[model samples]
Structure formats: C-alpha cells, structure tokens
Target: MIEIKNLKKVYAGVTVVNVPHLEIKSGESIGLVGNNGAGKTTLFRMILDLIRPESGEVLSNGKNVSGAEEWKNYTASYLDEGFLIDYLTPEEYLYFIGGLHGRNKPQVDEYLASLTEFFNGEILKKGKYIRDLSKGNQCKVGVGACLLQRPQLLMLDEPFANIDPSTQFRLKNILKTENKNLGVTTIVSSHDLNHVTDVCERILLMEKGVIIKDIATSSSTLSELEEYFGVGQTTSTNTGIDNEENH
Candidate 1:
C-alpha cells in the first residue's frame, strides 16, 4: 500500500537515505534492521512527512504522502517520546487519542480492558502523568494509543528497546496478531535481529543511506542476520558485511 520512488534525503552534503525504489503491499509485515547512523529513523520520518526529502516522493495508495492527508487516517506511528503528550496522565492521553478516532468513553474503556494483559497492571489507575512514568511505561502509553486507533498501517521504531523481557515477548505477540489475524500492515525498525525476524515476514537491511538487502524471512533468517552483523564470527575484525551480492 506504500511506494517510494528515488527517495533520498541529505544533510550537509551527506546522503542519509537513498532508496531508489521500494513497494510494500497491503497487509505486509516488514522489519527494518540496521546499525547506528544507518538512516533508518531518518527514512521513517520522511515517509511520515515529518521531514522534507531532498528528492523523490513517498506515496501511499498512489498519492504522495507529503501532499496528501488521506494516508494519515489509516496510518499510525510512534518513534519516540516526541510522539507522546507526556504531561497528561496515561488514561487521559489514551482517552484523548480514542476520542480523536471517534471513540467514546465506554468504547475506550473496553479497549483499555483488552490491553490489560499487555499492560500487565502497570499502566492503568496510576496517579502519575505520563511524563512521570519510566521510559518503558511511556512507551506503553504511546503504543496503546496507536492501537486504539485500529490503524491499517502501523510503524514503530526500536519497539523492543527499554522494555522488560516479558513486555518484549508481549509486544512481539501483539504485532504478530495484528499482522496475521487483522491483516494490518506493520513496519518495525529495530536492532534486535531475532525479535524482528520473529515478528516480520520480510526484512530490509539498510546501511550508509542505502537499502543493501531485502530478504524474505525464512528458517535461516536469524542466523543470516547475525552473521551479517558479525555476531556469528569468531574473529574480532569482522566487517559486519555479507559477502553475498546485493539483489
């Protein structure tokens, strides 16, 4: 449901993102994996029109995202604390988000109830504002608000970071359910190879402003990714590069 053509973003003469062309079909789950300074977050910001691209356009359903509002109706993204209204309590923040989607108090309460297991009793009925919560708790509030929208396309950055291990497992299962059961298009950018591979059907490996590999996840995907990252190597002088030719 999304397409990119010659999408390139530059900063101070350095190309941070330079994908020539890419397409994501409806209901596809995509995992984006890369190292630090690999342009992953920059690309996400451009696609969401949070930043202007120096060249090319990102299209959602054939319409340029930067010039169109239709895509926002079905797209939800959470990249960082910048996406949260930290001054509001978790309940208030969630309620505000639900109301934006035309949900009433009762409807929102029901939705919150569904997230009980996901929240693990740490998110609701708290006396603190979202800003007072731990980083991981704030993240939960953000994701909860996004899910309350019942979006068709969802994007998250480093969703596995800063959360407890139990919460990570819960997040992975939630993503899988959203993708497979509800047919939502989910895109996750993370450094955690195993978690991303378990949740996404396809993986995109980006480095130095370029998408170097687009892989369809299979039984060996985790091992292959670890190898590419030099984690599987015995020598410390690894290049963190796969010798296989890029497709």
Candidate 2:
C-alpha cells in the first residue's frame, strides 16, 4: 500500500502540487488524468522518490519512501527517457536492473522469456545501445525492464505516447494481466481517456496542480468525465465555452 499525506511541491515560487491525503491499496489499478502542467508527473516523481517534495511524506507499506531502500526493491517505475541507460544495450540494461532487484541472470532470462512477443525480437539480440533504438523500441525496452522483477508497485507515465496502436493494446492487456495475476498495485498517467477507462478501477482528475475530482470507474463513465473536463464543472465556466467554440 502507498500513502501520501499533505504532499506539496513548489518551483520558482509557484506551487505545482498539493494533496492533503491520498491512499492506494494493494492490487488496485489507478489512472491519473489532467491537462499538461496539472502536476501528474510531479506527483509520480514524488512517489518514486526521484524528486523531493517541499513538504509532506510518501509512505510505502508504512515506511517513508525517502528513507526506505527496501521499498525501492518492491517499486518499479518508468517515466521518460531519463530512466533508461542510454549507453547500454537492452539486454544489458535489463540484466543490470534485475541485478539491482536482487535477481540473477537466469531469473532475468526467465522473466524476459515470459514477455517474448512484447519485445518483438528488437530488445533481446540487438547489440546496439538503447539510445540507438527508435523511440518506440526504447519505450518497449524500458517497460520490459521495469516489469522484469514483477514489482509490487508499478508506476508509468505516458506509457503509450510513442508506441503504435497494436503495441499499445498489447501493453494495456499486459498491465491488466499483471495487476490481476501478480496483485501489483499500479498507477498510470495518460492523455488517452479510453486507455485509462479500460484499465483503471479508480480515476483521479487534476486541474492546475490540484486534485479536483476523484471518481470510481465502476460508478462513472468516460463520457461523463469528458463532460466534466469539457465544461465549467470544476474550473472556469467561460473556458469551456471558449473550447466549444474553438471545436
């Protein structure tokens, strides 16, 4: 389980994110949605301990994330290109990350074999560095590496941005299977509403650095969410009218 308490982040004298309390239980898949600069990425970073929050605490299973090295072993995250080792080949990178999680080479190979088709033969035998791979291929390698350990907590930001539609569908199914089979708690952020609605059990709506709405997918539909985002429901009403005219 992950618990966030009074989390806050600021940059250049402007507050970027502030959440009083949020908790995610184990075996749940969550979707975070917001316009650009809505602080979704910042919130994920804080949870991953990649960036420090100005105030508040992020706890994993009751341990403070910042001080919990054990928690790192259980958490796997992929955000952007920065998370990948540009200098290493995909195979080497996967082995390295697996080693960090205390898995041996045989264990890594076993995990890779399970994701055989997802790699499309590009990641396993390619001798080229990850930086040399195409953006889509690089994303595949990053995602594959993150899943190698079958982590307890998985967080991905814009996981489908660069992939083709087929691969996107494959990934969505893979995530769903992992969540159900392994009981991995997952959090995903994406602009694709259909993808989010299909995979997440709970959805969080953000606007200008604050969480304005939290709805269960079981109780709400994506069309209703589109309406919330389309009109003056949470933020400014006139902005919705302007958007409608522009459309």
Candidate 3:
C-alpha cells in the first residue's frame, strides 16, 4: 500500500501540488485526470522519488519512498520519454531493466516471448536503438520493460500518448490482467477519460494542483468526467485512440 501524507510541491516560489492525505491500497488501479500544468506529472514524480516534494512524505508498504533502497525493488515507474535509454535496443533495454530487478536474461527473454504478438515481431529483434524507433514503439518498449520486472507498484504518466488504437486496446487489457492476476497496484494519469474509466477502479480529478473530485469507477462514467473537466464537447469519441502512452 502507498500512503501520502501532506504532500506538497513548489517550484520557483509557486505551489504546484498539495495533497493533505491520499492512500492507495495494494492491487488497486487509480487514475488521475487534470489539465496541462495542473501538476499531475509532478505528483507522480514525487511518488517515484524522481523529484523531492517541498513537504510531506510518501510511504510504500511501510517504508519511506525517498532514499529507501528496499522500496526501489518494489516500485517501478515510467514518467516520460526521457526515462528510456536511447542507446539500447528494445531487447537490450528490457534485459537491462529486468536485470536491475534481479531477473536473468532467460527470464527477460521468456517475458518478451509472451508479448511477441503485441510487438508484431518489430520491436524485440529489430536491433534498432530505442531513439531510432517511432514514439509509439518506444512507448510500447518502455511499458513492456516495466512489466517484465513485475513490481508491486506501477506508476505511469500519460500512458497512451503516441500509440495506435489497436495497441491502446491491447495495453488496456494488459494493465487489467497485470493488476488483477498479479495483484500489482497501479497509478495512471491520462487525459483520456475513457481509458481511465475502462481500467481504473478509482478516479481523482485535479484542477490547479488540487484534487477537485474523487469518484469510484463503479459510480461514474466518462461523460460525467468530461462534464467535470468542462470539456464535454471536446472529449474524444475516437474509440480510445486519442492519448499519449507514457507507461
């Protein structure tokens, strides 16, 4: 479980995010929705210990996230494109990430084998540096690497940005299966309400760095989420294809 207490972030004398108390239970999938500059990414970074919060603490499984080496083994996160190692091929990148989590090459290869269909034989053996792959393919490779580790907590930011529609659907199913079957807790932030509604059991709406609404998926719909964001008219009905995959 993750417990965030009085979390706050400030940059250049400006407050970005402030959450007094937020707790995410193990194996739960939670979605965060907010407009640009609403500090959604900042919050995710704090949880991952990529950035320091101005105040408060984030604890996972009874250990503090900041400067906690043991917690590193249990948490896996991908915040943006920069997180990928541009010099490595997709297979190499997967192997490197799995190795960091104490998995061998054979284990990485076996995990990649299961995801072969999703890659269409284009990623695993392509022998191209990750920087050379298209953005969509890079997103797929990053997400695939994270899954190979099988961490207990996964945090993703804008995870559907550059993927094709078909792949997005596949990713949704993959996330659901991992969360349900493996009992992995996930926190995903996306502007695509439909994707969040389809996968996450809870949704937190942010406005100007504050959570304006928190609703359970069982009690809310994408349409209602659109209304809450005041973008109902612009909400995509394009069959879940209009998002950037940042997992």
Candidate 4:
C-alpha cells in the first residue's frame, strides 16, 4: 500500500534519512527498531508527509502522498502529544477526530466503550484537559484518537515507551487484531524490542539513517535481535541486510 523511492533528508550537512526503495503491502504489520538518532521517526514523518524529502517520493495506493489528499482519508498517525489538541479534554479530542472521519457521537461513544480495558480507567471522564494529563495518560489519549479513526493505515511512533506493562500488552493485542482481523496496515516504531516483536511479523533495523536489516520475524527473531544489540555494534559491520535469512 506504501512505496518509497530514493528518499533522503539532510540536516546541517548530515544525511539523516536515505532510503533508496521500500514497499509495504496492504495489511502488513511492520515494526521499526533502532537506537536514538537512527532516523526512524524522520522516515515516518516523511511517509506521513509531515516532512518533505529532499529527493524522491512517498506513494500511497500508487499516488504520491505529498501530491494527493486521498491518502489522508485512510491514514492515521500519532507520533507525539503534539498531534493532540492539548486544550481539549480527552473525550473532546476524540469526538473531534471522530467527526472528521464522519463518525457521529453515538458511534464514537460506542467505540470509546470498547476501549475500557485498554484505557484502564485513566483516560475517560478524567475532567482534565489533554495537556493536564500525565505523560502516559497523554499518550493514551493520542492512541485512542488514532484507533477511533479505524484507519486503513495506522502509524505510531514509540507507542510502547510511556504506558505501563498491562497497557502495553493491551496495545499489542489491539495492533495484532487490527492487522489480522481488520486488515489494517500497521507500522509502529518502538524502543521496546519485545513489544514490537510480539506485534509485528516483519522488523526493520535502522542505523545512521539507513535500513540495514529487513527481517521476517521467526521463532528466534527476538533472540537474533537481542544478540545484535547485545554486542557493541556499528553500521559498518552489517551495512544493509535486505533478506531475512541473514539473521
């Protein structure tokens, strides 16, 4: 559903993102993993058209994302709390997003009801603006907004970073259900290795703004990744591992 070609982004003479070619098929659950300054979020921003690439293009359903508004109709992304309307309460923020998606009040309420377990009783009826909530609660609000859209393509950055363990597991199940049952194309970047591995069937390891590894997760995928990160590593060792068996 998404294709990237010759994508590159430079900052102050440093090349932060340089993806030559990448394609993500519909209903694919993808996990992007990398250390800090790896440019994972930069790549995501470009895909969402929040940042224009210095070269190349991002295509959604065969249309360049930068040139078309159609992709926004089916795409939902939440990278940070900046995506939220901080002045609005959680319910208000969600309702606004639902309205944009053509969902009425009743439909949004029903959907919010379904997220009781995921919210763990901290999100709704809090009586506080989104900016007043704690970091984890703010993240919950952002994720709730994304899910409310029932998007065809969902992208989240570091979604597992702020929430508690129980909420993390809940989110993993939600993502899996969205991909396997609803056929939503899910792309999530996370610092937690276990969370990403459990939810995604494919994993991309990035370094120095390059996709050095494209691994199809297997029974031993977690261990393989752990091993890769365990030892002090550098991009020079495995510059670009395109296939799964290399792991």
List ranges where model 4 is wrong by over 4 Å: 232-247
Per-residue C-alpha lDDT of model 2 across residues 52-105, encoded as one tens digit per residue: 999999999999999988898788888887789999988899999999878999
Model 4, range 175-204, lDDT digits (tens) per residue? 999999999999999878998999999999
| Residue-by-residue lDDT tens digits, candidate 1, 1-247 | 9999999987777777899999999999999988766788888888899989999999999999989999999999988888999889899999999999999999999999988987989999978988899888888888989899999999998888878999999999999999999999999999889899999999999887799899999999999988888964233222323211111
Q: Name model 1 segments beyond 4 Å from true.
A: 231-247
Candidate order by decreasing TM-score: 4, 1, 3, 2
- Candidate 3 C-alpha RMSD relative to the actual structure: 4.8
Off by over 4 Å in 2: 232-247
TM-score of each: 0.93, 0.90, 0.91, 0.94
What TM-score, to 2 decimals, does candidate 3 have?
Answer: 0.91
Q: Give the Å shift of residue 230 in candidate 3.
A: 3.0
C-alpha lDDT of residue 179 in model 4: 96
In model 3, the runs with Cα more than 4 Å from the true position are: 231-247
On the 0 to 100 scale, the lDDT of residue 95 in model 2 is: 93
RMSD of each: 5.1, 4.8, 4.8, 5.2
Location of the lowest summed lDDT over 10 successive residues in candidate 2: 238-247
Model 3: per-residue lDDT, tens digit, 147-224? 887889888887787788888898899889989999999999998888999999999987656887888897546879
